[model samples]
Target: MLIFPAVKASSRLPATSNNLHPEKHKDLYAVTEQVIARAIPLWNLSLTPVRLPLVSNRIKFKCPEYDMYLEDMSDSEGPRREDAKMSTNEKSAEKNGSATCRTSSNRNLGILSLVSVPPHLEDQYPIEGPRELKPDNTVDIWREYEEDGLQIIAKLANIHLTPEKPEYEGGTWHVEGQLHICASAIYNYDSDNLTTSRVAFRQQSNVQRAELKMSYPQGDHDFLEEVFGCEQGGSGVQDLVTVDNPEGRLLTWPNILQHQVQPFNLVDSSKSGHRKIPALFLVV
Candidate 1:
């Protein structure tokens, strides 16, 4: 399996593979890169990086006013301690924002709170807001979906893995909703006490056409299999890239390519772990 390198949040471009030889990959692009896209005009290139001087540094916790409910978000779980006074149920409740380190009943897990301080947005611009509307845009590919209306289907879910059931077997190769799904977005809100996990993508390739174009006379299409490192007999599944999924990360992609969730397990021997995600599918 090919592991992709980590890309920072500022990246807004197609990725070039280090593994691919420039000469060979460019030559294959004529036969393999079948999909070409038209430009869809977008607005607002500036006004980002909201570095407001007055409140940027002042905001410590997202909602400091609600500190009564939260213990403050931390990058990692602190040292696990035993709570002798608490019941077994209370101890296990640690997974749901519950804390064993609390000294008394004054503190409780804030995870269940319906409303709290919004996440601190210093320089980050979350795409969920209504910021990217193009008024003067010409007719584009998505114009059909936007003319009347379109709804985005969302699925809120979490996977819990314990010592008893530690492994999350990889998902099957499929699109988000088979046909109607145009785009999909997955937000990894929380992934605690788990090993590194990844999501993979593969796209259908024009095997017969590519073979005919590249090696019609010789009757030898070995390079199609060897160069791309894929078996040629079956349906052409061109492995694209595997994305490393981490906490607070948002991954979005068009639904034309099939994708799957890679398997993951708990990092610790006894501790329980879970990944909380909300997947959104856009159907036209």
Candidate 2:
């Protein structure tokens, strides 16, 4: 009988090469490098330390006082607190008949109290009273936000940004680059954590789009925790860094850094809350 001996399944298995699972053997490092190439220029720019403060590149923090001041005076609204103190001062001034000017005693005025401090103390008041609160004149407030953004960017990029006068020629200073501004309003809704690790732009026919991502400074993580009230540590998902959304704060970062904003929910359903952000990108 020339019957062949029965062979075990293990012995019948064919020899396989190192790439047994070709699908799982993808070059992830190569893919990451290719993705990062999109942001190489900007990354280099952030590092290249151009000592001009001609533009702002920083993240602004929550200015509750500023917000309160703006909201109060918005639409020419009157202060809820009766300016009894101001009235008293005015009555005293009139009784004294000396154009009396006393410092503002209203604690609710926030940073607006600075207006009381005279520039020359020669009775030549620039901000005479609360009525002089013009939004345009509040450039100093905007400067605070600008400085905040610059500070964060300086720390991240390991560069010093000093205020420098722009080069002037002919009749105007020569400024290089286009200012790209984008504003987004976030209400009581959640958004997916979108990474701004790479620069992307697209245009087709009539449609045009550009996107930039900003992240808060690492030192502000605790502040984010307090604001977000996230009891849990780390992102629930692994292999990701947790950061709070810039949320009305002016934030700037190299396009190479990965960042994301956690979903936020309002504590009070009866009241409305919103986070509005306006970002500026300088493209040369």
**Candidate whose TM-score is highest:** 1
Candidate with maximal lDDT = 1
Question: Global lDDT of each model?
Answer: 0.50, 0.27
Lowest-sum lDDT 10-residue window in model 2 = 150-159
Tens-digit lDDT track for model 2 on 1-284? 01112121111111221323324624532332222222223333443322211122121223111222234454445454433344565567548853333333343343312233223542543344422333343222123322232111001111111123111111121211224211111111121222211212111111011001212223323333332233235432222233344322233343223333433433343344333332223222
Q: Where is model 1 more than 4 Å wrong at Cα?
A: 1-149, 226-229
All candidates: TM-score: 0.47, 0.20
RMSD of 2: 25.6
**Which digits, one per residue and each the tens of the lDDT, describe model 1 over residues 1-284?**
11122122111112343344557667533322211111111101111112222222212222111122224545363322234255465457545754222222333222321111233542343423323334443223334433343344556678999999988897889987556666676778779998876899987767666454331214334334544446846667778889998986667666666899999998995989999876756555
